[model samples]
Target: MASLTCRADCTHPANHRHLRFVWLYFTTVNLSALDLNLLLVFHTVLEEKTVAKAAAKLHVTPPAISNSLSRLRAVIGDPLLVRRGRGLVPTPRAQELAPRVATALRELERAVGDDRTFDPATTRRRFVLACSDNDQIASVPHLAATLASEMPLAQLHIVSIDQLKASDGLAAGIVDAAVVPTAASHADVHAEPLYVDHGVLVLRKGHPIRAPRLSRAQFNSLRYVDTWIVLGRAGVGTKMMDAFLHRHGLVRNVAVIVPGFAAAAMIVATTDLAVGMPMRVAVQLAKHLPLRVAKIPAPAMPIEMQLVWHARTHEDPGAKLFRALVADAFRDKPRR
Candidate 1:
């Protein structure tokens, strides 16, 4: 039993010619009579345009190069290269094959030749991340700043979690990473804790339900703002806020339904609507608005926000750095 592998210095001038030849040879589907030697001979003939030159490069006599070309010419059913006054000119078929070969050779060179350590500061690689609306508010700005300072040449793309359900961007390589709840975690993904947060109810400062503690009945009597998207309604924190309501067979009287925390906060600030949101973001919103915080009537709901990457990219160097930056971004905010 033998194993085959491709490990080559594709940039080495001598090897490049052979790779170019291999690429050219592949275009003709019939390889039943393939011989490695003839492929090299044909490419060398087209490349050097003279047997004497190719032979000189290969450290072989012109007769040997000529014999190898004769075999290739029989299999290809073309003259391949014909003698001019003092050199050779490729036949039309051979000339047509050159461009295709060059394209594949370029791809090959990129894959094997450019194998080196990923340097974040120098790479112009594009990285994609997916997050729901609130998670974006939580991590995007700080991550953007980190990118601007350390990974200046790298590009960042932030997409919504909705795109992931339509197509698995992470496993498919369209998305590099995501900031999501641990419920999305699976065997094929790597999850790293970004932050631990809990939900708090935000309302206008002069609202009627300003009691030191809110009873379930009082909590239900008020109008509420709900977020119905991935992280808004279906998220762990939201479910925790509603847990008490579920247990007591009572639900919040829905007044306004929005897709995100910011929207919920805005609805809560001006109107009688009260929204349950992460305390970290709610605190920030409260600072600039006429908003007041209230403990959620529900028991402790610790939202575990995590950074997730497909196992495919879990060990990628650039991805590792990206993950570190994401972790650093959340680490800056106060934990409730």
Candidate 2:
């Protein structure tokens, strides 16, 4: 016969149940009775905070969630849910069960998370990642070097995109992950912060507009060489710049709009146009061109770089390990 087991911690109002969780332990119910599935559902419901959302997450109907909550209440002898606003709120008892229940569930999940171990040294899986040209030039080199030396069989494919995602390409697995400015909106997607970058103004060293100190007015008056590539691949830079200009009631005369920073740099070097780029990128371009970098008197508007991945892959052994490696490689190494 199946039986339900109640832990002492479940005595709280929030964790109390109407339907006792049933567990079959070797066809006997002498000392233990617990339904692990119900606990998982309970956890999801608490996290979501609404029965409808929990049902959607679990692929069930709202009534099923209510029934489970009823059972939980009866088993624990407490009104686990009380009406508040348009939803049910957990009481003090429910809050106490949260951490302990979560810890126990995590321990169980870790024990069953993977059936086999991943050996990066021997695996030959190829990873495809989408990122900007700046990331390709500045970021991938170190990753390539490490993978080549350590995981010899692993190959990395870098896909350069002008914008992060115009649609759900990443959701459909068109790309494994991307370095995006903002986290993807999909509930199943996750973004981990990598680094922050700031912008700088660049121009020819001897240009007339290259004042010892370029005021916002002087900076706006000069013809601007705009990079059409759009930082973070979604016209993010254009939007950010436009907002700042609007706030200050300034407008730039865009002399040219090119598809890349390289093109913008080339135009700025040969013409009387100024370009705005991240400090590191400007420094890099300066090495090969006759250009100089100028500090914007305004406080640098910093943008964060994040590693965005699908939620389904978040817990994968290989993906997690590789993500750790990538994060460590890009960890804030301030420019000397």
Candidate 3:
């Protein structure tokens, strides 16, 4: 084979195109002969900046990591990493290749590692979920119990994240999935309707509000407790209720604002303040507290809770299993 080379000043379009082809061909040839696992070692060593640290991370011996580094250097024809006083530093070429190699390794792992059959009873995978306070109240208990019984070894971490940042967190791999009222519009985020719940009025068990319903006048006159979190500005229920009330020329007296739905529920259960929240959430809270659930006087606002995840993990077995578990746990059932 003739040696392929490109001049610095190859101004001709055809020459530029040929140069690109040659570069791609050489890259493919280089990668075809390289061991994919070596890339993992290379990335670890670059990240850790020492063979000993990389060995510890990969659960291998330092000599093995050094040998792998030698092989990588020979194959790539570059001193990928160089030793300084006590640490190693990546060369210019290694620095340039680091991100691409890391990305490729992550993608490869996601493609192969997660495609295996999921065995919930045996696997020790951990799944992180981003949920609101309401989701924590309504869904977490059931989910925790179900997972504890069905997947004893698996772990679950529920985190409170801003709803608006849910998509960003999923995309960035901060959380595996998010339980939100509305789906995000990001192209890389995937959303599924988990369940549809409606807003209801919550008050103390023997408060003034009666069963079945409360008149619009009574509803407007009662003091209200609002749950205001950092992301409360984008609350779907609040926005919808405001719009509905605006249309009817009515507004509830928001006498108090609490940090979360749990707190609001607690306040409403013992005081004259009443809260409007999802029926499922209110019902769950009422089970533990002296609270009563009643129909919202205004037109009903259906809160469609959704499960959102990144497209990158769409096919990941663990992610898929967790998504299925959440959907099954929260799936709406007919009233008996």
In lDDT terms, which candidate is top? 3
Q: What are the per-residue Cα lDDT tens digits for candidate 1 across 196-281?
A: 87767788999978875577787878888888765333555446556656886557888777778787877788888887777778
lDDT of each: 0.71, 0.67, 0.74
Measured by TM-score, the strongest candidate is: 3
| Count of clashes, each model | 0, 19, 0
State the weakest 10-residue window (summed lDDT) of model 2: 18-27
Task: List model 2 lDDT by residue over 1-336, tens digit each.
Answer: 011223444434453232222222212333223355456666777777888887667654576567667756655556766778877687887776655555455545544554757888998977777777666655677777776776789878877664335434354344567776654465667888889888778999798875655787887788888776664455766777868766766667888887678888888899888888877677778988999988665667786788887765667677776776666655467221
lDDT of 3 by residue, 205-254 (tens): 88966756887787888999987655535555466677877786667889
Stretches of candidate 3 above 4 Å error?
A: 1-115, 163-167, 229-239, 334-336
**CA RMSD (A), model 3:** 14.5
lDDT for model 1: 0.71
Per-candidate TM equals 0.64, 0.59, 0.65
Residue 175 of candidate 1: its Cα lDDT? 80
Greater-lDDT candidate between 2 and 3: 3
- Backbone clashes, candidate 2: 19
What overall lDDT, based on C-alpha atoms, would model 3 receive against the true structure?
Answer: 0.74
